[model samples]
Target: MTSSSIAEQVSTFNEGFTAQIGPELSAVFDAEQQALTAAGRPDDAVGVGDQLVDATLLTPEGAEVSLATVVGEGPAVLVFYRGAWCPYCNLTLKTYQEQLLPTLRDRGVGLVAISPQTPEGSELATSNGSLDFPVLSDPGNVLSRALGIVTEPTAEARAAHTQLGFDVADSNADSTGDIPFPTVLVVDGDGRVVFADVHVDYTTRTEVDEVVAALDLLP
Candidate 1:
């Protein structure tokens, strides 16, 4: 085949492959969401103990903040993310901003959102609206990888992401590619992960009310 024809065939194949993978990924996400919903909330808290992981993350103001220090003050609500580019993460953050932050603050609990996004992207996402809490940037997914929550996307998923114009690289420049499943942890004053929920699905999240109730249980 001619060079032009060969190039055209390759492009066509990529497109077809992307199309095929998109629906499959969507189904996987849907199934995972359903399973998480059916499982309901965990009755117990997360096991972080006194050995809280210490990592520096860039805040929205471009300042470095330590995760352990933040949690050491009092009870803290830490929300982990794949990146600011994710719709589910955005929704989850917004929900917390709207619904959970006030309640948590009333009870003397600090709120923080952690992601692998660069400082610029993290600031942009938070600046778009009112996020009273700090958005921390975890470059290289160093903390997430240490927490055993980092996962690489499959080749097909990457192809589908490219076809869909989703810039995972820009979303998580520091991490290179590893993404974290959306997870939330409630840490008490003693530096323990009091409550934790990590979901395989990106669509579902812990309800804001549920988090408040969990905070209420903490001393």
Candidate 2:
């Protein structure tokens, strides 16, 4: 709604969070982001021209659905996020709902969001964002792991999360901290990825404009 980039919105959130959490906890998160940056994207991570593997994903109601069915013979934008408990995830998803979904709809592209969270978490994300597109549960990161995009919070970061009375495992259906690095992929009707953007830093996200431009370039 604001037309500002997700990066700008996230910057504002980070400033406010730093003000609330103070320097100590903020440093812990900063260290985590730096570590992720140093580690870099996984060598085996899925990319453009790769064919995505189909997997059973859960709906918000706990029913099962196939990834192929979700794609529905059209180009789709797949968003991978940590969970509903993450403020950054919530903000990104809401922004996609407001900004990305309309353009995607007009282009006849499907939009789907996947997370390792349980059905309840998926429901919360959908309701919070008032999203019309499917918000799916990846359970144990089945599809994400297959894509080589899975990662978990470091022990130090996990401790910081605990200090804040939050644990990543608590929201996950697998009862583990495993989550997909914030990633977005544009796949063709045949399920081959045409474009992929992965963010090792959770504070950043794939922008709607970039995604639209990618879609525009598709053959």
Candidate 3:
């Protein structure tokens, strides 16, 4: 378990990455984040009181399962991430495995992480993080788009990705760069969202304490 908070971990990674990529490329990423911030949160993003929309998702093994089935008859914490290729996503998921999973399990709440990546990519995420929760693939961004949380990297970012030696589309099942804004939603057994937190910036994440606070509000 990492002792550092997600924000601190992200800051450390950002500093190292910036140093590796140099100022010019780092500026490109900075501009991209600024653009996303300027765009603001999606108006139609599903929020508290909204019912969860059912969608078919793939397990890391490639077996299809419905979102409701994954959550079963209990409340759940649904995490929407970019992909396994994202360092920030990996860090956040790993932290959840260490810090949040025990609390969620103790309360009988399910935890599922979803992304528009291939089952292979999902497998890597699960294995890399040593995650106990279900890591599902949302091929084609179907579920994420339904939640109105889809976004893609800017052209400059894509070029930066090329320079970084990998393309987001390559890891995605949809073969596209589209991804969800990093989001966390707490939904009741009946599928009504009790709490929702969406981060326009990929570097930020919903902390374990925040989820526990939301759970405390549940009936």
Per-candidate TM-scores read 0.76, 0.98, 0.98
Q: After superposition, how far is residue 126 of candidate 1 from its true place, in Å?
A: 0.6
C-alpha lDDT (0 to 100) for residue 213 of candidate 1? 72
What tens digits encode model 2's per-residue C-alpha lDDT throughout 22-135? Answer: 899999999999999999999999998999899999999999999999888998999999999999999999999999999999989999999999999999999988889999
lDDT of 3 by residue, 83-185 (tens): 9889999999999999899999999999999999999999999998999899999999999999999999999999999999999999999899999999999
RMSD of each: 11.4, 0.8, 0.7
Instruction: Rank candidates by lDDT, best first.
Output: 3, 2, 1
* Global CA lDDT computed for model 2: 0.93
Window of ten residues with lowest summed lDDT in model 1: 1-10
lDDT scores of the candidates, listed in order: 0.69, 0.93, 0.94
- Model 1, C-alpha of 49: deviation from truth (Å): 4.5
Overall local distance difference test of candidate 3: 0.94
